[model samples]
Target: MRCHPLLPAWRAAARCLGALALLGAAVVARGQGVGAGVGGEAEIAAVGAQVQQLARDSAGRAGLRDARIEVEVGQLDPRLKLAPCQRIEPYLPPGLPVWGRTRIGLKCTQGPKPWNVTLPVTVHVYARSLVTQAALAAGTTLAPEHFTEAEVDLAAAPGLPIGQPGLAVGRTLARPLAAGSALRAADLKARQFFAAGETVRVVAGGPGWQVVTEAEAMNPGLEGQTVRVRTESGRLLQGRPVGDRQVEVML
Candidate 1:
Protein backbone atom coordinates (compact mmCIF):
# COMPACT_ATOMS: atom_id res chain seq x y z
CA MET A 1 0.00 0.00 0.00
CA ARG A 2 1.20 3.51 -0.88
CA CYS A 3 0.96 6.25 1.71
CA HIS A 4 -0.71 9.54 0.90
CA PRO A 5 1.61 12.52 1.25
CA LEU A 6 -1.05 14.58 2.96
CA LEU A 7 -2.06 11.89 5.42
CA PRO A 8 -0.29 10.87 8.59
CA ALA A 9 1.00 7.33 8.98
CA TRP A 10 -2.06 6.20 10.95
CA ARG A 11 -4.47 7.76 8.48
CA ALA A 12 -2.62 6.17 5.59
CA ALA A 13 -2.83 2.83 7.36
CA ALA A 14 -6.57 3.36 7.91
CA ARG A 15 -7.07 4.00 4.20
CA CYS A 16 -5.24 0.82 3.41
CA LEU A 17 -7.42 -1.14 5.84
CA GLY A 18 -10.58 0.26 4.29
CA ALA A 19 -9.43 -0.74 0.82
CA LEU A 20 -8.61 -4.23 2.05
CA ALA A 21 -12.07 -4.58 3.57
CA LEU A 22 -13.64 -3.60 0.27
CA LEU A 23 -11.50 -6.11 -1.57
CA GLY A 24 -12.36 -8.86 0.88
CA ALA A 25 -16.07 -8.13 0.51
CA ALA A 26 -15.81 -8.24 -3.27
CA VAL A 27 -14.06 -11.62 -3.18
CA VAL A 28 -16.58 -13.14 -0.80
CA ALA A 29 -19.57 -11.69 -2.70
CA ARG A 30 -18.32 -13.21 -5.93
CA GLY A 31 -18.07 -16.65 -4.32
CA GLN A 32 -21.66 -16.31 -3.20
CA GLY A 33 -22.72 -15.68 -6.82
CA VAL A 34 -24.68 -12.74 -8.20
CA GLY A 35 -28.02 -11.70 -6.64
CA ALA A 36 -27.24 -13.59 -3.44
CA GLY A 37 -27.01 -11.93 -0.03
CA VAL A 38 -23.47 -11.59 1.20
CA GLY A 39 -22.55 -14.36 3.61
CA GLY A 40 -23.08 -13.25 7.21
CA GLU A 41 -19.77 -14.76 8.26
CA ALA A 42 -17.87 -12.93 5.54
CA GLU A 43 -19.56 -9.63 6.30
CA ILE A 44 -18.91 -10.04 10.01
CA ALA A 45 -15.26 -10.82 9.36
CA ALA A 46 -14.85 -7.68 7.28
CA VAL A 47 -16.39 -5.57 10.02
CA GLY A 48 -14.09 -7.20 12.54
CA ALA A 49 -11.03 -6.38 10.45
CA GLN A 50 -12.07 -2.76 10.11
CA VAL A 51 -12.72 -2.48 13.83
CA GLN A 52 -9.37 -4.01 14.70
CA GLN A 53 -7.59 -1.62 12.36
CA LEU A 54 -9.46 1.33 13.85
CA ALA A 55 -8.39 0.41 17.36
CA ARG A 56 -4.79 0.01 16.23
CA ASP A 57 -4.84 3.31 14.37
CA SER A 58 -6.41 5.06 17.31
CA ALA A 59 -3.83 3.65 19.70
CA GLY A 60 -1.01 4.53 17.30
CA ARG A 61 -2.25 8.10 16.99
CA ALA A 62 -2.28 8.29 20.79
CA GLY A 63 1.42 7.25 20.84
CA LEU A 64 0.67 3.65 21.89
CA ARG A 65 2.29 2.14 18.81
CA ASP A 66 3.42 -0.96 20.71
CA ALA A 67 0.21 -1.42 22.66
CA ARG A 68 -1.41 -4.83 22.31
CA ILE A 69 -4.91 -4.62 20.88
CA GLU A 70 -7.58 -7.33 20.64
CA VAL A 71 -10.92 -7.06 18.89
CA GLU A 72 -13.99 -9.25 19.38
CA VAL A 73 -16.68 -9.04 16.69
CA GLY A 74 -20.10 -10.31 17.78
CA GLN A 75 -22.92 -11.94 15.88
CA LEU A 76 -25.87 -10.16 14.35
CA ASP A 77 -29.40 -10.66 15.65
CA PRO A 78 -30.66 -14.05 14.53
CA ARG A 79 -34.16 -12.71 13.88
CA LEU A 80 -32.94 -10.36 11.16
CA LYS A 81 -32.29 -11.56 7.61
CA LEU A 82 -29.77 -9.82 5.35
CA ALA A 83 -30.16 -8.61 1.78
CA PRO A 84 -28.29 -9.51 -1.44
CA CYS A 85 -25.40 -7.13 -1.97
CA GLN A 86 -22.58 -6.77 -4.45
CA ARG A 87 -20.72 -4.45 -2.08
CA ILE A 88 -20.66 -4.08 1.69
CA GLU A 89 -19.01 -1.31 3.65
CA PRO A 90 -17.99 -1.34 7.27
CA TYR A 91 -17.86 1.86 9.24
CA LEU A 92 -17.54 3.20 12.78
CA PRO A 93 -20.71 4.79 13.94
CA PRO A 94 -20.27 8.50 14.67
CA GLY A 95 -19.81 9.43 18.36
CA LEU A 96 -19.27 5.76 19.24
CA PRO A 97 -15.57 5.27 19.81
CA VAL A 98 -13.75 1.93 19.54
CA TRP A 99 -13.16 1.56 23.27
CA GLY A 100 -14.34 -1.33 25.43
CA ARG A 101 -17.80 -2.54 24.42
CA THR A 102 -18.84 -0.82 21.18
CA ARG A 103 -20.46 -1.52 17.83
CA ILE A 104 -19.41 -1.52 14.19
CA GLY A 105 -21.65 -0.50 11.33
CA LEU A 106 -22.25 -2.65 8.23
CA LYS A 107 -24.15 -1.23 5.30
CA CYS A 108 -25.05 -2.84 1.96
CA THR A 109 -24.24 -0.45 -0.88
CA GLN A 110 -25.21 -2.51 -3.94
CA GLY A 111 -27.87 -4.82 -2.65
CA PRO A 112 -31.41 -5.70 -3.84
CA LYS A 113 -32.63 -4.62 -0.38
CA PRO A 114 -30.60 -1.76 1.08
CA TRP A 115 -29.91 -2.45 4.73
CA ASN A 116 -27.68 -1.38 7.60
CA VAL A 117 -27.04 -2.97 10.97
CA THR A 118 -24.74 -2.72 13.92
CA LEU A 119 -22.44 -5.57 14.94
CA PRO A 120 -21.33 -5.84 18.55
CA VAL A 121 -17.63 -5.32 19.12
CA THR A 122 -15.25 -5.17 22.04
CA VAL A 123 -11.83 -3.51 21.76
CA HIS A 124 -9.33 -4.49 24.42
CA VAL A 125 -6.25 -2.30 24.73
CA TYR A 126 -3.63 -3.85 26.94
CA ALA A 127 -0.62 -1.99 28.27
CA ARG A 128 1.41 -1.51 31.41
CA SER A 129 -0.83 0.19 33.95
CA LEU A 130 -1.18 0.61 37.70
CA VAL A 131 -3.16 -2.08 39.49
CA THR A 132 -4.09 -2.34 43.13
CA GLN A 133 -1.84 -4.73 44.98
CA ALA A 134 -4.58 -5.58 47.42
CA ALA A 135 -8.26 -4.79 47.94
CA LEU A 136 -8.41 -1.17 49.03
CA ALA A 137 -11.40 0.57 50.52
CA ALA A 138 -12.74 3.93 49.46
CA GLY A 139 -10.90 7.03 50.73
CA THR A 140 -7.58 5.25 50.93
CA THR A 141 -4.75 7.65 50.17
CA LEU A 142 -2.59 5.99 47.53
CA ALA A 143 1.09 5.45 48.21
CA PRO A 144 3.85 4.07 46.02
CA GLU A 145 3.44 0.59 47.49
CA HIS A 146 -0.34 0.62 47.26
CA PHE A 147 -0.32 -0.39 43.61
CA THR A 148 2.05 -2.03 41.21
CA GLU A 149 2.57 -1.93 37.46
CA ALA A 150 1.09 -4.68 35.34
CA GLU A 151 -0.09 -5.33 31.80
CA VAL A 152 -3.88 -4.99 31.88
CA ASP A 153 -6.64 -4.08 29.49
CA LEU A 154 -7.06 -0.31 29.66
CA ALA A 155 -10.52 -0.51 28.14
CA ALA A 156 -11.72 -3.19 30.53
CA ALA A 157 -13.53 -0.39 32.32
CA PRO A 158 -14.39 3.28 31.86
CA GLY A 159 -11.87 6.11 32.22
CA LEU A 160 -8.18 6.14 31.28
CA PRO A 161 -6.00 3.83 33.38
CA ILE A 162 -3.20 5.30 35.46
CA GLY A 163 0.22 4.09 34.38
CA GLN A 164 2.72 6.31 36.13
CA PRO A 165 3.45 6.15 39.83
CA GLY A 166 3.28 9.92 40.12
CA LEU A 167 -0.30 9.95 38.80
CA ALA A 168 -1.55 7.38 41.31
CA VAL A 169 0.52 8.31 44.33
CA GLY A 170 -0.92 10.75 46.88
CA ARG A 171 -4.38 10.49 45.33
CA THR A 172 -7.37 9.20 47.29
CA LEU A 173 -9.61 6.49 45.97
CA ALA A 174 -13.21 7.48 45.35
CA ARG A 175 -14.47 3.93 45.50
CA PRO A 176 -13.28 0.57 46.69
CA LEU A 177 -11.26 -1.42 44.15
CA ALA A 178 -10.59 -5.14 44.20
CA ALA A 179 -7.10 -6.56 44.26
CA GLY A 180 -5.42 -6.86 40.87
CA SER A 181 -7.92 -4.39 39.37
CA ALA A 182 -6.56 -1.77 36.98
CA LEU A 183 -6.51 1.68 38.53
CA ARG A 184 -8.17 4.41 36.46
CA ALA A 185 -8.53 8.15 36.87
CA ALA A 186 -12.22 7.65 37.64
CA ASP A 187 -11.19 5.50 40.53
CA LEU A 188 -9.54 8.47 42.24
CA LYS A 189 -11.43 11.13 44.09
CA ALA A 190 -11.38 14.70 42.87
CA ARG A 191 -9.16 16.71 45.19
CA GLN A 192 -10.92 19.70 46.70
CA PHE A 193 -8.70 22.78 46.92
CA PHE A 194 -11.24 25.30 48.14
CA ALA A 195 -14.77 25.13 49.48
CA ALA A 196 -17.78 27.13 48.33
CA GLY A 197 -17.97 30.79 49.48
CA GLU A 198 -14.20 30.86 50.03
CA THR A 199 -12.13 33.66 48.60
CA VAL A 200 -9.69 32.18 46.10
CA ARG A 201 -7.06 33.70 43.88
CA VAL A 202 -8.03 33.92 40.21
CA VAL A 203 -5.35 34.37 37.59
CA ALA A 204 -6.17 35.24 33.99
CA GLY A 205 -3.33 35.49 31.55
CA GLY A 206 -2.68 35.89 27.85
CA PRO A 207 0.32 36.50 25.67
CA GLY A 208 2.47 39.20 27.29
CA TRP A 209 -0.08 39.98 29.96
CA GLN A 210 -1.23 38.64 33.32
CA VAL A 211 -4.04 39.62 35.67
CA VAL A 212 -4.63 38.35 39.18
CA THR A 213 -7.60 38.94 41.42
CA GLU A 214 -9.59 37.35 44.21
CA ALA A 215 -13.06 35.91 43.85
CA GLU A 216 -15.52 34.00 45.98
CA ALA A 217 -15.85 30.46 44.75
CA MET A 218 -19.47 29.68 43.93
CA ASN A 219 -18.68 26.02 44.08
CA PRO A 220 -15.95 23.89 45.53
CA GLY A 221 -12.71 24.24 43.62
CA LEU A 222 -11.55 20.78 42.69
CA GLU A 223 -8.15 20.14 41.20
CA GLY A 224 -8.18 20.29 37.42
CA GLN A 225 -11.93 20.98 37.50
CA THR A 226 -13.80 24.13 36.56
CA VAL A 227 -15.17 26.28 39.34
CA ARG A 228 -17.58 29.21 39.11
CA VAL A 229 -16.45 32.39 40.89
CA ARG A 230 -17.78 35.87 41.51
CA THR A 231 -15.24 38.67 41.47
CA GLU A 232 -15.24 41.57 43.94
CA SER A 233 -17.58 43.55 41.71
CA GLY A 234 -19.92 40.54 41.51
CA ARG A 235 -18.74 39.59 38.02
CA LEU A 236 -19.31 35.86 37.58
CA LEU A 237 -16.79 33.81 35.67
CA GLN A 238 -15.55 30.28 35.32
CA GLY A 239 -12.02 29.02 35.75
CA ARG A 240 -10.12 25.78 36.35
CA PRO A 241 -8.54 24.94 39.67
CA VAL A 242 -4.76 24.90 39.37
CA GLY A 243 -3.62 24.78 42.97
CA ASP A 244 -4.63 25.28 46.56
CA ARG A 245 -7.32 27.99 46.49
CA GLN A 246 -6.09 29.02 43.07
CA VAL A 247 -7.89 29.16 39.73
CA GLU A 248 -6.60 29.94 36.25
CA VAL A 249 -8.52 31.33 33.30
CA MET A 250 -7.12 31.66 29.82
CA LEU A 251 -8.23 34.79 28.02
Candidate 2:
Protein backbone atom coordinates (compact mmCIF):
# COMPACT_ATOMS: atom_id res chain seq x y z
CA MET A 1 0.00 0.00 0.00
CA ARG A 2 1.17 3.50 -0.75
CA CYS A 3 1.77 5.78 2.22
CA HIS A 4 1.47 9.54 2.68
CA PRO A 5 4.66 11.53 2.18
CA LEU A 6 4.69 12.68 5.87
CA LEU A 7 3.52 9.35 7.30
CA PRO A 8 7.05 7.95 7.78
CA ALA A 9 8.19 11.11 9.52
CA TRP A 10 5.24 10.95 11.87
CA ARG A 11 5.88 7.28 12.60
CA ALA A 12 9.56 8.02 13.36
CA ALA A 13 8.56 10.80 15.77
CA ALA A 14 6.04 8.50 17.47
CA ARG A 15 8.72 5.84 17.96
CA CYS A 16 11.06 8.43 19.49
CA LEU A 17 8.36 9.57 21.91
CA GLY A 18 7.57 6.00 22.91
CA ALA A 19 11.24 5.25 23.54
CA LEU A 20 11.50 8.41 25.70
CA ALA A 21 8.46 7.38 27.74
CA LEU A 22 9.96 3.93 28.31
CA LEU A 23 13.26 5.47 29.38
CA GLY A 24 11.40 7.77 31.81
CA ALA A 25 9.53 4.80 33.32
CA ALA A 26 12.79 2.90 33.74
CA VAL A 27 14.32 5.87 35.55
CA VAL A 28 11.29 6.13 37.87
CA ALA A 29 11.52 2.41 38.68
CA ARG A 30 15.21 2.76 39.42
CA GLY A 31 14.52 5.74 41.71
CA GLN A 32 11.94 3.69 43.57
CA GLY A 33 14.51 0.94 44.14
CA VAL A 34 16.92 3.52 45.59
CA GLY A 35 14.55 4.36 48.50
CA ALA A 36 13.12 0.86 48.98
CA GLY A 37 15.60 -0.34 51.63
CA VAL A 38 16.97 1.78 54.44
CA GLY A 39 15.26 5.18 54.62
CA GLY A 40 12.50 4.73 52.06
CA GLU A 41 11.06 7.44 49.75
CA ALA A 42 9.84 9.69 52.56
CA GLU A 43 13.27 9.80 54.21
CA ILE A 44 14.97 10.41 50.89
CA ALA A 45 12.64 13.35 50.22
CA ALA A 46 13.34 14.79 53.68
CA VAL A 47 17.06 14.54 53.05
CA GLY A 48 16.67 16.47 49.79
CA ALA A 49 14.74 19.21 51.60
CA GLN A 50 17.43 19.45 54.26
CA VAL A 51 20.12 19.69 51.64
CA GLN A 52 18.20 22.48 49.91
CA GLN A 53 17.92 24.43 53.16
CA LEU A 54 21.64 24.00 53.72
CA ALA A 55 22.33 25.38 50.24
CA ARG A 56 20.14 28.40 50.94
CA ASP A 57 21.94 29.03 54.21
CA SER A 58 25.30 28.80 52.48
CA ALA A 59 24.22 31.34 49.88
CA GLY A 60 23.07 33.70 52.61
CA ARG A 61 26.42 33.35 54.38
CA ALA A 62 28.17 34.11 51.11
CA GLY A 63 26.41 37.52 51.12
CA LEU A 64 23.86 36.68 48.46
CA ARG A 65 21.01 38.04 50.51
CA ASP A 66 19.63 40.21 47.72
CA ALA A 67 20.28 37.61 45.08
CA ARG A 68 17.62 35.06 44.15
CA ILE A 69 18.96 31.60 44.95
CA GLU A 70 17.64 28.32 43.53
CA VAL A 71 18.84 24.85 44.32
CA GLU A 72 18.28 21.47 42.68
CA VAL A 73 19.26 18.30 44.52
CA GLY A 74 19.94 15.21 42.42
CA GLN A 75 18.78 11.68 43.18
CA LEU A 76 21.06 9.09 44.70
CA ASP A 77 22.48 6.22 42.64
CA PRO A 78 20.04 3.29 42.49
CA ARG A 79 22.71 0.59 42.37
CA LEU A 80 23.79 0.80 46.04
CA LYS A 81 21.08 -0.16 48.49
CA LEU A 82 21.15 2.17 51.50
CA ALA A 83 21.00 0.72 55.02
CA PRO A 84 18.62 2.00 57.69
CA CYS A 85 20.45 5.06 58.92
CA GLN A 86 19.77 6.10 62.49
CA ARG A 87 21.33 9.42 61.61
CA ILE A 88 22.11 10.75 58.16
CA GLU A 89 24.47 13.68 58.34
CA PRO A 90 24.47 15.97 55.31
CA TYR A 91 27.57 18.07 54.90
CA LEU A 92 29.25 20.19 52.27
CA PRO A 93 32.32 18.38 50.92
CA PRO A 94 35.54 19.89 52.20
CA GLY A 95 36.98 22.67 50.08
CA LEU A 96 33.95 22.68 47.80
CA PRO A 97 32.32 26.04 47.21
CA VAL A 98 28.54 26.13 47.58
CA TRP A 99 28.20 27.98 44.30
CA GLY A 100 27.61 26.56 40.82
CA ARG A 101 27.51 22.77 40.40
CA THR A 102 28.53 21.17 43.69
CA ARG A 103 27.87 18.04 45.72
CA ILE A 104 26.46 17.41 49.19
CA GLY A 105 27.86 14.42 51.03
CA LEU A 106 25.50 12.23 53.08
CA LYS A 107 26.92 9.70 55.49
CA CYS A 108 25.12 7.03 57.54
CA THR A 109 26.65 7.51 60.99
CA GLN A 110 24.75 5.04 63.18
CA GLY A 111 23.76 2.37 60.69
CA PRO A 112 24.69 -1.32 60.67
CA LYS A 113 26.54 -0.75 57.38
CA PRO A 114 28.05 2.70 57.19
CA TRP A 115 27.66 4.25 53.76
CA ASN A 116 28.75 7.51 52.23
CA VAL A 117 27.20 9.00 49.13
CA THR A 118 27.19 12.34 47.35
CA LEU A 119 24.27 14.01 45.62
CA PRO A 120 24.93 16.45 42.80
CA VAL A 121 23.37 19.88 43.11
CA THR A 122 23.05 22.95 40.94
CA VAL A 123 22.96 26.37 42.59
CA HIS A 124 21.66 29.40 40.74
CA VAL A 125 22.39 32.86 42.10
CA TYR A 126 20.55 35.50 40.17
CA ALA A 127 21.18 39.23 40.42
CA ARG A 128 20.58 42.32 38.42
CA SER A 129 23.72 43.20 36.46
CA LEU A 130 24.96 44.78 33.28
CA VAL A 131 24.90 42.79 30.05
CA THR A 132 25.88 43.52 26.47
CA GLN A 133 23.20 45.28 24.44
CA ALA A 134 24.52 43.74 21.26
CA ALA A 135 27.19 41.35 20.09
CA LEU A 136 30.54 42.98 20.86
CA ALA A 137 33.93 42.14 19.42
CA ALA A 138 37.25 42.00 21.21
CA GLY A 139 38.93 45.38 21.68
CA THR A 140 35.61 47.18 21.51
CA THR A 141 35.60 50.09 23.88
CA LEU A 142 32.60 49.79 26.19
CA ALA A 143 30.08 52.58 26.60
CA PRO A 144 26.87 53.09 28.53
CA GLU A 145 24.81 52.51 25.40
CA HIS A 146 26.47 49.16 24.85
CA PHE A 147 25.07 47.66 28.01
CA THR A 148 21.70 47.01 29.61
CA GLU A 149 20.79 45.82 33.06
CA ALA A 150 19.36 42.31 33.36
CA GLU A 151 18.92 39.52 35.84
CA VAL A 152 21.88 37.18 35.41
CA ASP A 153 22.88 33.93 37.09
CA LEU A 154 26.18 34.84 38.68
CA ALA A 155 27.04 31.25 39.56
CA ALA A 156 26.81 30.26 35.90
CA ALA A 157 30.15 31.95 35.24
CA PRO A 158 33.35 32.93 37.03
CA GLY A 159 34.38 36.53 37.76
CA LEU A 160 32.10 39.12 39.31
CA PRO A 161 29.61 40.97 37.12
CA ILE A 162 30.09 44.69 36.44
CA GLY A 163 27.21 46.40 38.24
CA GLN A 164 27.67 50.05 37.31
CA PRO A 165 28.11 51.24 33.75
CA GLY A 166 30.80 53.68 34.82
CA LEU A 167 32.91 50.76 36.03
CA ALA A 168 33.07 49.24 32.53
CA VAL A 169 32.76 52.36 30.40
CA GLY A 170 35.99 53.41 28.63
CA ARG A 171 37.39 49.88 29.03
CA THR A 172 38.15 47.68 26.04
CA LEU A 173 36.80 44.16 25.85
CA ALA A 174 39.27 41.31 26.22
CA ARG A 175 37.21 38.93 24.09
CA PRO A 176 34.10 38.79 21.91
CA LEU A 177 30.79 38.31 23.67
CA ALA A 178 27.30 37.39 22.46
CA ALA A 179 24.39 39.75 22.82
CA GLY A 180 22.74 39.72 26.26
CA SER A 181 25.81 38.15 27.88
CA ALA A 182 26.80 39.34 31.32
CA LEU A 183 29.67 41.81 31.52
CA ARG A 184 32.29 40.61 33.97
CA ALA A 185 35.27 42.51 35.34
CA ALA A 186 37.65 40.01 33.72
CA ASP A 187 36.06 40.69 30.34
CA LEU A 188 37.72 44.11 30.13
CA LYS A 189 41.36 44.56 29.17
CA ALA A 190 43.68 45.95 31.79
CA ARG A 191 43.92 49.71 31.45
CA GLN A 192 47.22 50.52 29.74
CA PHE A 193 48.70 53.84 30.96
CA PHE A 194 51.95 53.55 29.02
CA ALA A 195 53.64 50.85 27.00
CA ALA A 196 57.10 49.42 27.66
CA GLY A 197 60.09 51.58 26.60
CA GLU A 198 57.99 54.74 27.04
CA THR A 199 59.03 57.70 29.12
CA VAL A 200 56.90 58.33 32.23
CA ARG A 201 56.89 60.62 35.22
CA VAL A 202 57.63 58.88 38.54
CA VAL A 203 56.10 60.71 41.48
CA ALA A 204 57.58 60.08 44.90
CA GLY A 205 56.12 61.70 47.99
CA GLY A 206 57.32 61.70 51.57
CA PRO A 207 56.36 63.63 54.69
CA GLY A 208 56.18 67.29 53.60
CA TRP A 209 58.25 66.46 50.49
CA GLN A 210 57.39 65.51 46.90
CA VAL A 211 59.70 64.58 44.04
CA VAL A 212 58.77 64.20 40.37
CA THR A 213 61.24 62.64 37.98
CA GLU A 214 61.23 61.10 34.50
CA ALA A 215 61.91 57.40 34.05
CA GLU A 216 61.80 54.78 31.29
CA ALA A 217 59.18 52.11 31.77
CA MET A 218 60.59 48.58 31.51
CA ASN A 219 57.13 47.12 31.00
CA PRO A 220 53.59 48.24 30.26
CA GLY A 221 52.12 50.41 32.99
CA LEU A 222 48.57 49.21 33.61
CA GLU A 223 46.22 50.90 36.03
CA GLY A 224 46.49 49.51 39.59
CA GLN A 225 49.30 47.23 38.40
CA THR A 226 52.97 47.56 39.33
CA VAL A 227 55.59 48.10 36.68
CA ARG A 228 59.37 48.42 36.78
CA VAL A 229 60.92 51.72 35.64
CA ARG A 230 64.56 52.77 35.23
CA THR A 231 65.41 56.24 36.52
CA GLU A 232 68.00 58.57 35.00
CA SER A 233 70.55 56.99 37.32
CA GLY A 234 69.66 53.58 35.76
CA ARG A 235 68.22 52.37 39.09
CA LEU A 236 65.19 50.11 38.67
CA LEU A 237 62.17 50.86 40.81
CA GLN A 238 58.73 49.22 41.11
CA GLY A 239 55.84 51.66 40.84
CA ARG A 240 52.09 51.46 40.31
CA PRO A 241 50.45 53.06 37.31
CA VAL A 242 48.19 55.93 38.38
CA GLY A 243 47.62 57.97 35.23
CA ASP A 244 48.65 58.31 31.60
CA ARG A 245 52.42 58.04 31.39
CA GLN A 246 52.64 58.35 35.17
CA VAL A 247 53.73 55.98 37.95
CA GLU A 248 53.56 56.44 41.72
CA VAL A 249 56.48 55.26 43.81
CA MET A 250 56.32 55.03 47.57
CA LEU A 251 59.07 56.43 49.76
Could you give candidate 1's per-residue lDDT for residues 106-172 as a string of tens digits? 7788878887877665666677667889999999999988877677876677666766778678889
**Model 1 segments beyond 4 Å from truth?**
1-65, 206-209
Estimate TM-scores for all models.
Answer: 0.76, 0.63
Candidate 2 CA-lDDT value? 0.67
Judged by lDDT against the true structure, how good is candidate 1? 0.70
RMSD of each: 6.2, 14.8
Check candidate 1 and list the clashing pairs: none
- The candidate maximizing TM-score is 1
Query: Which lDDT value does model 2 have at 248?
Result: 94
Q: List candidate 2 segments past 4 Å from native.
A: 1-66, 82-89, 108-114, 199-216, 223-226, 230-251
Q: What lDDT score belongs to each candidate, Candidate 1 first?
A: 0.70, 0.67
